[model samples]
Target chain A: MDSTPEFVRLWTSHQAEIRRYLFLVVPRARDAEEVLQDVSVRLWEKWDQYDPNRPFVPWAIRFAYLEALKWRQRQAREKLVFSDALLVQLDASYEEEVPFLEARRRALQGCLRKLGDNERRWLWLRYGGHGAVKAEAVESGKKLRKVYYALEKIRVLLLDCVAGTLKQEGWSDA
Target chain B: MLKKTSRLDVLLGRAAEEMLSPEEATELEEILTRDPEARKRYLQYLDLHAELEESFQLHAVAGGLGSVFFPGVSGWRLWTGAAACAACGMLFASVAWAYATPVIQKAQRRTIFTENFEDRLAHQPTGLPRAPGAWSGDDASVVGAENGVLPKTGNSMLRFLRSTHAEENTPKSAWCDIYRLVELSTPPALGSRLSLSASFAVAPASDGEQFDIYVGLNALDTYPVQAPDLDTARNLSNTTLGRRLPATRNGKWHELSVDTQVSPQTRYVLVHLAMLRRVPGPSPSHVQFAGHYVDDIKLDLLPSNALPVKTP
Candidate 1:
């Protein structure tokens, strides 16, 4: 019952993976973050139930999945949301992408540095400042369509850069 | 030259922004099902979006990543800026530490037992009886939520009161000793350090009322009968380790943390919160006064390295 040290180690090691898994399951980042907190509490409460013989990531992911489902039920009235089947499909794909996503996260700083000054500023306005695309457009005196397109372009560039960096570092999907 | 925007790219962008309509979502699903390349690209874009969002949150918590990503800043200036940022970060962290030291200190120690007196009242019946997890002296009555003293954090607090009725020349002591047994799975070994802490407030009705609060650890099997006097309670065989706290007549909540050595043959520690009152009377009316209001009682077993080094 006194598994504090073991639980801390397991939780610290799998926190990022849990967060990413919740993010994939839940649509909104806020909802995903809330579910992450729930998952943390649930993990602590059920720490004694965890089997040391098995891998911790999958065990943690099961808790994350349950919490995400609970969150989805709470937000059932929201629009454009995925069904349980679709979520299961996404979760399956997410499990496969966890390793690659970690590498991409590592390469993100370099990729962000490679962005153009204007692109970086736009990114700051949108993601960094947490301003919406419309807000960015209003702030920069650009049309909403133009802001959206610009952001889309910047995202594509970042994605391409991350892929290139990973490939250069000899990271392949296979 | 800029590459033309593909349908998949447009769908991915809308999906990232959560702006995809039902029609667009259906089309995107069709594309994802039909083309493996589109599905791969979609997952990658989603992953990138999540990474960027998470990075922003991380940067915000780390006091912003502005200095590291400033455009056109040269080597010396960057180093200087980084150093300045580091200095600012240190300053900000120090201030945060000052505000969060108590919470950080509590979080660092492993809690062996904690009772906030929040849930105990709800489980108690209507009459003034002992709390669910607490055992009180014969003279003590645990006031339930209805007439209970207001809690520091939760809905109720452990209100210990003793009333003395002395006829002419009889000088008697009124005391309330409340203790709860905290069964530990891995009990502290002999000579191991432990800490007992609780916030208490005394509300003496008159100047003649004297309040004494004692917090301590006792062995599980050793049950000590409630003693009428403070000296008798202190010298009890069950009380392996304890400290008598100073009276707080100001009526403000004062926190008392006592460090003591763990005794042998202790599978569980009894966290005792005793409120003793010595009332000297030559009065016409019965003297009534509240002894102590206790809340947030906690006991922690300190790690060996956390113990204070004794100087020779």
Candidate 2:
């Protein structure tokens, strides 16, 4: 049986987990995403060996961590943001923590909906707005610090809401 | 609220932006290495950071006018006009990042433009067939965010006030639409394709004629504004790709997206988002609009060989 369809189905469901796993090990967005691409190719080449009974992410994430370390090695002249010991330590335990991460991600949607006009505008300015936004902010007579502080406040609100929402939804361990 | 921000949280925030100093990075690793609780907080914050970025990615070019998000169509044009005096083409960096990727490397996907109806300052449609080409709609079309009307995403959304829009000085009630003018002087990639996606929300359900929503991506030889007057309906008819949204009575947002290959000779692309009243005969009601809403308009340019991302 050609597992192409099955591989595509399982890969679609678990790719985000792998992206998140790589994010923890590789701090740079472009580099982390690069490692993700490499890991994706590696996974597809090896999908014939994947066992349905075994958890997909935990099995797949090992490849992401390995490629991430290779990226780290290429930049070894500089001090590493995340040490190898930490990445290895994380690989062993990340599978247990994914549920809470996913729960938080779900809770964020509801929290975003709860934002007021000003709160939403601040998030849009800091995150969704374009690259020259800092200079634009200054030129428009709005303080960059004001936007940063406002963003920090909003993130706290979102994180708190996530925790509360999960608890209310009976995710006690979250 | 959490009492005082932790040292770990401060460090992680900087880390998300890739701004952490070498010393700060080492310290961050030490804390995560020693404390189990700290490690948990690190993962949660990093997860939050990534999720927030991804959500914004869906809304990357909300209110963007080929460059940055403009509060209103005119205000942004004025601001960019004045800003461009200092640095020409600096503002038009909407087409930034054109890295060469072979057809097979799909991970390098990037959003080229978006128009989430976040602009509240416009009373009439903003981009009405200009020499450069921009957004165009009816005098009745406006950004709505009042009377308990909620957008699918962002603070505001495009609301059709009436069932008719003026084209060539004649009011046409066949469909009410908002047009996004995409003028790409050069093809993004030789084999790349363009993806247009949008969300439409339902108003009151009707019995007489079913109202359908569609998003149109049409590649044109000349820019929309450069086209002679009486532009819209003529260009829309030459659509290269049209995607009809799924019919739903649930009163929720319906997402529709389409991908089309842009010919190398293509120069300008007109994106049409409309609510159509396809009844055999005209009725008294403004059925073309039928009170539906549009939001979260996004356009992405993907390499020709781009495919769904493979993962572990």
Q: Against the true structure, whose lDDT is highest?
A: 2
lDDT of 2 by residue, A36-139 (tens): 99998998988778765234676798778788778777777778556677877666556446635755776798898787766665565555554445755676
**CA lDDT, candidate 1, residue A147:** 84
Number of clashes recorded per candidate: 0, 4
The lDDT of each candidate is: 0.60, 0.62
TM-score of chain A of 2: 0.81
Q: Candidate 2 residues B1-312, lDDT tens each? A: 324566777778778767788899899989889987777777777788788766654433211222233232223433333333333344233212211111122345568787765666533454244533345765445455543446888787877655545443443355666666676745666667888999877654547545557787766666533444333323332235555532343356767778866666666677777776544445554544545677888888777546332233
Where model 1 places Cα greater than 4 Å from the true spot, the runs are: A4-13, A53-55, A70-78, A132-136, B33-36, B60-68, B71-312
Rounded to one decimal, what is candidate 1's iRMSD?
14.7
RMSD of each: 24.2, 18.7
Q: Over 4 Å off in model 2, which ranges? A: A1-14, A53-55, A142-146, B1-4, B59-312
DockQ leader: 2
Estimated TM-score per prediction?
A: 0.47, 0.47
